[model samples]
Target chain A: MTPVPDPSEEWRRLDRRTVLVTAAVLTGVAGGAGLPTVLGLAGAMPLWRAVTWVLAGAALLVGGGAAADYVRWRRTRYRVGAERAELRTGLLLVKRRSLARERIRSVDLTAHPLLRVLGLVKVRIGTGENAGGESTLELDPVTKAEGERLRRELLDRVRPDAPDSPHDGALAVLDPGWIRYAPASFVAPLLGGAAAGAVMQVSEWFGAQGEVIEWIGDRFQDTSVLGMIVVLVLLALLAGTVGALGLWVEMWWNYRLEREPGGTLRVRRGLFTARSISIEERRLRGVELVEPLGVRMCRAARVDAVATGLVKDDEDKHADHKTLLPPAPRDLADRVAAQVLRESEAPTGAPLTAHPRAARTRRLRWALGSALAPVAVLAVLGAALTPVLLYAAAGCALVLVPLAVLLALDAYRNLGHGITGDYLVTRSGTVRRTTVALQRGGVIGWTVKQSSFQRRAGVLTLTATTAAGEGAYDIHDAGEGEGLAFAAEAVPDLLAPFLKPTGVRDAGVETRKTRG
Target chain B: MTGENAIRDEVRLRPPRNAVDERAVTWWRTQLLLTTTVPVVVLGVLGALLQPARFWLLLTAGAVAVAGLAATAFFPAWWFRVHRWEVTEDAVYVRTGAFWQEWRIAPMSRIQTVDTVRGPLEQFFRLSTVTVTTASSKGAIRIEGLDHQLAADLAERLTRITQDTPGDAT
Candidate 1:
């Protein structure tokens, strides 16, 4: 065992290069602010005078920011002792924070292009407590080497006997070919819609909506109405594809998932702003394979770590850092999941027991009801108002009914739960199908919910509540008996002792009747 | 199958009935009436004073407040009858909710912390509420209307059980 280092020790300051980075950011901001003023003064004022004014403003801002940053850097000190990692900063107020070493669950590193150029990275050491800013200690602008060392030393929990293991290797690396799935994501169409909305908003803001609409109309004047609509849609799709590709590149460029000498799993990704998220293996509860509709159709899925102490905060910059694997071939995703769990086979790929047809009926009814609401509203409007409204009603019915039915059927098909060795797998959803292979041991409690409607349908929602991941994995619309039985079997005595005898027997009979 | 049936029968055996102190009903009734009536009375006065033309509104509000006060006074006795909790060697069973009855079972091993809280009203009534926090995201399970001494005892017992049970890393 390593000796516990002294806590009451001298605090070390961050690298001086932080001042340069701070000054550069302030200069950029000043330039952006001064641009409009300079442009407005182009003809009104003397060119040299205007230019000098802008230059002076930029210099003053940068100079003041750099001086402040220098003082901040000087005052900001961090120390990683055996028991705790402490950070103290602020020139006037003097704020101090210390995270117990045992409670330290994650040490994430981030470096933007500017910081990267200067070989500096920002390190955030978190205790994994869900309590806002109080749980994290940030050390901004540390040297690259120092960052790497801190990551290793802070996360070093390897067994002394085994200095290196075969598992200590790059589990997954960025595949350029995976970029094709970027445009295939559902985000593409969403981005396209957002772009169109943005165009309208900007034009409205500038009072150029009429001019923009006229320009579009003139461009498509020669085409037939149908052809014009098709062309517009295709153009929107093209723009969407480009936007999705750029977003994908920015978020996932150079993505690498690797296992260190210790039991830490590190995910390094991003292009302009690189991020390194470290998760201890012991804290990892499981992995979730996410297949959004578009990506699923493309035979691709994303992987996420379902680990304890990886609390998502509103202010957390690396909110999406939970993504362990980028959208890739489902086969590759499965393999990476298995590798992360240190298992020979991925639990997600295991065959799951399908839910009863009653579940399907429920989903179908819900889908039809939801889809018909708009149609019903439109039909009422059409009857009361113009015939043009009737056409819209017809259009809505024609598009929504079939789509809703398909989604409902797909959701029914996806509803399944199974246990494979140490993990219990539960699959659900239509738009964003998720198969979570949660560790059975991780589940601390069970909640069985049966509403009056559910009781009439002889179905119940059983949730395995754990401390990690989403905190609960639910098996929705399962036959009450089957769900109870499964829950009892999954965790053994936990749920068994709570169920009434007659209730269990009746549920068993019901289960048999439904299955038969 | 027979062993399973036996276990089921054992499960069906009603959990130990530990009802809250009898004074809790009086406390709850008083608190409920005070909370509901004070707000309504103020609103009624404000309505009559601010808008004399809507004096009928003030009468209507008073009537509704009376009805609400009556319901609040009566509901506490009914709630006191239904709201019960039992702490077994291995689990804590709390049965709550009025119209939609909910029975929550939290395993002793999963318990992270057990706390006894006394609000101003509860303190005045010499009562405390026990909160058993588990690792589950559904949040803590609270058992209100307990004698202060009983609440302390329960909290201590739960804490001791949790400490004794291994594999409670959470």
Candidate 2:
């Protein structure tokens, strides 16, 4: 996307980038220093010093990055003199991407605690006449007044008091500290990243008999041979844990599951970083109320979507990309689902026919058992991994075994989603709860699958695809009989438009009721 | 009037059809033979290089390689599967996929862009393939099975269809 050339626009844009660079550089240097300090204790100090000196030299080279960013940022300004919001930015290589006022879809304002204190808010404006190309363009943090002005200017035609968008809804509840500080959330990351950082810090120790460290250090530059290998492995694990925490934290805060006053419903969440999103009311996608029997006992169900992008933490299916919320409260899930789905009742279709009693669920145990088999397989995967496990020490192995088991148990949960008529709602999640509000209009297609095993168990899995693109937003698992029935029967009713070569719908047609 | 007539001439000149990169089919067949079979063959011959002493251990990698190689044999067939595209009154469906079914359907209305691409291999083959990416998902639905001239003709047809805008959702 190009931005127009405003005289000095580059400098202003770079200024914003420069500040972020400063923050990153400061964090990296500080974060890097901690590593060497710890590695010194691991009996590799002398070698570590040499490795650090090289790194410190490299950091010096990038010292001007922050300054460069500042220059670029200071030069940028929105030339809103007339018909367009001329976004002129970039430095050495310039770009100008302009979005006319008429193209504005919605204006969203977001602020973190830091941004709030700075009296600045970041705004994202969704535009583009169709789903193609940049759906949203970001505006650098602006003061509240400027943000309001921009909002007013762009959305002049839209109802100012729409009241039911993602930003303004009864469901937009800020999370309390208790949910944020959940022991599972903090303990895992603290133990993981800190222990890893601590372990690496010792690996660079340049102390007595450091010749081996010297040899490895001398082998690679731009990287110490040992440091690079060790740090990269740690980073991989760290990244994975970071991702898991991201999902955990995102579910914890700004966790709003609301039925907007407008016919659409949205579930917006994030912990440190948040997202403000609104779906087209008529574009509610196919949904599933999955009851992973194991997570059910724990009262947790993961509600993801069949979205097109690469996230939302469910297994990658075009149908199930975004996890609607971590886990939310039942009463709240119902209210939000009812509103979004236009259902008279909130979605509560858990294994209603099969397991009449909630407490006595074997499915939870069954799901847990299958999930745990992978752990055993991983453990038995020894030949390729013997060196790694041998370092654990036998006693630690005994303790680690039980921890994995307990966590697996906690993950067991049961949930379901059903589309009674035109509206589709799903109930899921354990520790936190989630219910998705989907409609026939949002979905693009239907999919039905039944394993020979499922037929024997009187189960059928249904996956519904939506126009949301890839991942779970496209497909999701549902209870067998009900799921397939919904797929072959209910889905055709919902997505009948796409099925026709000509997408023109019959006039005066309302939503078709659930054939299921 | 002059520009319109010239464009009309170019449109009419587009050939009816052409075929996908036969070289791509040939190259894949060889790559399949090497990566899939080479390692297993080496492991089978060497004791230390072999997998565990379990009953089917030696055969496991080799078995997987064989299945993979078998699948690779059909790579060209799979990759160049879409030689036929009939835009019907009902819908546009292209049959692809090896095991699980893949029938890409793009109604005339949702068609966004009609493009042609030639990867390095296809360039060598003097082949340009057509891509009909719709507003459905992420990437466009590409039909590489078309012959080069046919690809150009189909692209023009698609472009014309999109331009017509039939008024009532096409």
Question: What TM-score fits each model?
Answer: 0.85, 0.56
Task: Please list the C-alpha lDDT of all candidates, in the order they appear.
Answer: 0.81, 0.48
For candidate 2, write residues A1-516 as lDDT tens digits.
244575223322311433664556565675666555545444545766656765665466455665665765665655554466666667666667677765554565655545555556666666523443344556666665566566655555533455434434564364463242232333345556665665555643544235655664666567756778886567656664665455556545666655544433345555554444444333345333333433344343334433332223122121222444443443444444454444556554423222111212334555546655655555555436785544443444566556645543443333444555565554444443444445545444333333444434433334444445341232223443234334444445332332322222342222322233
- Tell me how large the interface RMSD of candidate 2 is: 19.4
Q: Under CAPRI classification, how is model 1 graded?
A: acceptable
Q: What does DockQ come to for candidate 2?
A: 0.05
Query: For residues B60-169, could you state the per-residue lDDT of candidate 2 as single tens digits?
Result: 66686878778787765765553334555433445443333333445555566788987665555556667775444532566663556767877788788777855322
Q: What is the lDDT of residue A461 in candidate 1?
A: 76
* Model 1 per-residue lDDT tens digits across residues A416-455: 9878888888999999999999988888877666666765
Is model 2 an incorrect, acceptable, medium or high docking prediction? incorrect
Clashing pairs for model 1 are none
For residue A228, model 2's alpha carbon misses the true position, in angstroms, by: 31
Off by over 4 Å in 1: A1-10, A36-60, A160-166, A197-210, A222-233, A311-319, A385-391, A503-516, B1-82, B98-101, B120-127, B163-168
* Native A-B contacts reproduced, model 1: 0.27
Instruction: Report interface Cα RMSD per prediction.
Output: 6.2, 19.4
Chain A TM-score values for every predicted structure, listed in order: 0.89, 0.55
Candidate 2 fraction of reference contacts recovered: 0.02
User: What's each prediction's clash count?
Assistant: 0, 103
